[model samples]
Target: MVKATINNFESLALSGKTLGSISYATRKSVGRKSETDVAQVNLNESLETFSIQPQSGFDFSTSMGTKLKLVNARLVATEARSNGRTSVVQGVQGSLLPVSDPTVDEYDEAEYDMVFVTGKNRKPVARVRSKDAFDSQDLVLFGSDVLYKTDNRNQVIIEDDEAQKSGYRLNFVQSKIKDDEIGHLISIIISVDEYERLAPSLKPSQKYVPQGLRVAFVGNETTNWTLYADTVVPLTENNKQAVKVDSKPNSNTAVKADEKDMKK
Candidate 1:
């Protein structure tokens, strides 16, 4: 039996402020518990032994030559050996022992995979992969635990906070447009690699466009519709095109006397 205290109107039951204590009781009931169980039991023997202090903010684990942060860390890949063994590689961070290691519990990997610590709003920030191969989108994201690497041998590791906060960013190359899909003029940005991704469908042209510039869509006519960025639009009799201008048409020109007579 242990003696404890509860203050500040905080609950002391199994579902309340005492998780470790309840976990201990649960482990004792289950017969499978950690070696730290005895120390944890002694700590709970007195209320003072367990501090009920409130968390100030995000706290990272950086002990025993290991640096693990819930927000910034990502699980990269899990490998299965021929001997029926396995280990997980944490991108930018080292590997962890097999999830079934005697020192670690089965739920340990799941718990650390994407969990935010206390005072961290309990958000999942990363993704985990257990295989070597994955798709193109997975390569751009840090959450994907893939083994794919660039020519430089750098596996892309995205910042979870940045990905959560902002939209997906990519490095694109000049890609061609599908002639059939090119309808009324809208705008598009493409990279060369993106063009290749759409190959066999996209129509080929002689010249390549500069990067990061917006290209307006033109109709079925292929030759005269496309032009360089700085080219001037010529208002001609046969070719009537809508031009984007700085100012709106003058409102005074819209009022007509014939229109007023029609209203009466």
Candidate 2:
């Protein structure tokens, strides 16, 4: 027989006390009852060999093994493989719980491709593709506000800085507009390569625009619009032309407006 001292009252069988004693039979029987029922005899022997002691908290131990403490309200076992053999080993959960791995949550290149278009068009114009496909009636945003809809077909592409360096290309269609109707100014955000190729013909007076500046193109005209390094001047409520100011500052001039106050 083995004697164990209970230190915690959490167990319903040993409640309302700081310490108590429980006896267990450790010896195995040498008779027919024991031979016919091996499982029960082994279970009783294991229960007697292991002891539970409570100090600051409960600690469980077998006579020949190290004590194990409960973690996250449960006991966990971990295994590692090496040289075609698997072995249970101690792990970080006992020391560092709730760990995070950044690589596990990172997006793959295929996922990035799903969000943008990759192709060619007849015209030399640049194109912007969104990770999401938009319908003609769907509203598209330039920065923080909606600038136009897919129906206009003049929206520009905005590529991430890292993505531009990878030589990804987009497709743009030539604008078709009637000569009688007033032409609308369409703006696009593009990579540096696309901007350099089209900049010469567009003849934007200012060559150095802000990193994410939008290049505005006149409807049907294709290559006639001013390029300024100033903040992106959004189109007016009528979507006819960009709202600008006449003042020029050091060659980098743009029509200015209270961007915050402008409505979508």
Candidate 3:
């Protein structure tokens, strides 16, 4: 048996308060049992919230509204390789360790891949790939086929938490993957400008395909689930057109002249 793995962020630390109840969900399929315990926490640096799963049987005694800092947390992607060229993605593996820390925000802060951590002017302390390959973003986001969209004036955390910026967020499933058929889904956050520009075309009456900025663990590397584009760029119309043009067969290519006639 061969092992396949990838590590992008070696360390992930965040200080935030619990947003909602931490619940454990049980998912059963065929002969397997899976734990779907997820924690919804709000970032202390801002009001942005994200759901992350924790280790099994973790202590959840920490009640809501308590200041917590994620400790010993990292993002990893795994795959189980069998015979040559035969393997399957094992999904993202890692756990969030939110330890109570009341003074987490007391320290001057820095940003890494849009995630805030304690300390001032702090750069990336650890990375999986070379500095050029991985800096802040080690995740790729691509989306198509709009499932749902939020209010355009809603606030989303793309950069530092600041007031007065408004935009929209939507869940876009990859055009190639069916949601019911697979568990792959991507959430895209768009700037207000992008939203306004695409609003007319996005009417319910119009046929629209949306692609935007979203973070997702991808099997970009064979050995590990590491390496993502520097930024999550929404797919564009020109790009779509280019694909269609490129995929079509060339009509100008000359064909062989009458091979059967020559044989006769």
Q: Write the per-residue lDDT of candidate 3 for residues 1-264, one digit (tens) a residue.
A: 223122323333322222222232222111122234445555443455445555577555555565444433443333343444533332322344445333333212222122221121221222121221132121233322211221344322243444333333333333443434322333334444555566544532122332211123334332222121111333455543421111111223211111111111
Residue-wise C-alpha lDDT for candidate 1, range 1-264, written one tens digit per residue: 222110001111111111222111111111123111111111223332211111123112212222111112222222223344433211112212222334422233322211111111211222222111111111111110111112233323346532211111122112222223222111122223333344443322212222211111121212111111111122333322222321222222211111011111
Residue 89 lDDT, candidate 2, scale 0-100: 27
Clash totals, every prediction: 7, 5, 3
Off by over 4 Å in 3: 1-32, 44-48, 55-57, 78-216, 220-264
The C-alpha local distance difference test score for the whole of candidate 2 amounts to 0.22
Worst 10 residues of 3 by lDDT: 255-264
TM per candidate comes to: 0.14, 0.15, 0.27
After superposition, the stretches of candidate 1 with alpha carbons farther than 4 Å from their true spots are: 1-69, 78-84, 87-264
lDDT of 3: 0.31
User: Taking the tens digit of each residue's C-alpha lDDT, what string does model 2 give over 1-264?
Assistant: 222111101101111011112222222321222221101111122443322222232122223223222122111123445565654421111111111312221222222111111111111111121112211111222222122221224333345622112111122111232222232122333334443454444423222112222222221212222122233222235333222322212222222211111122
Predictions: Cα RMSD each? 26.9, 30.2, 20.2
Q: Score residue 51 of candidate 3 by CA lDDT.
A: 50
Query: Candidate 2, which segments miss by more than 4 Å at Cα?
Result: 1-182, 188-221, 233-246, 251-264
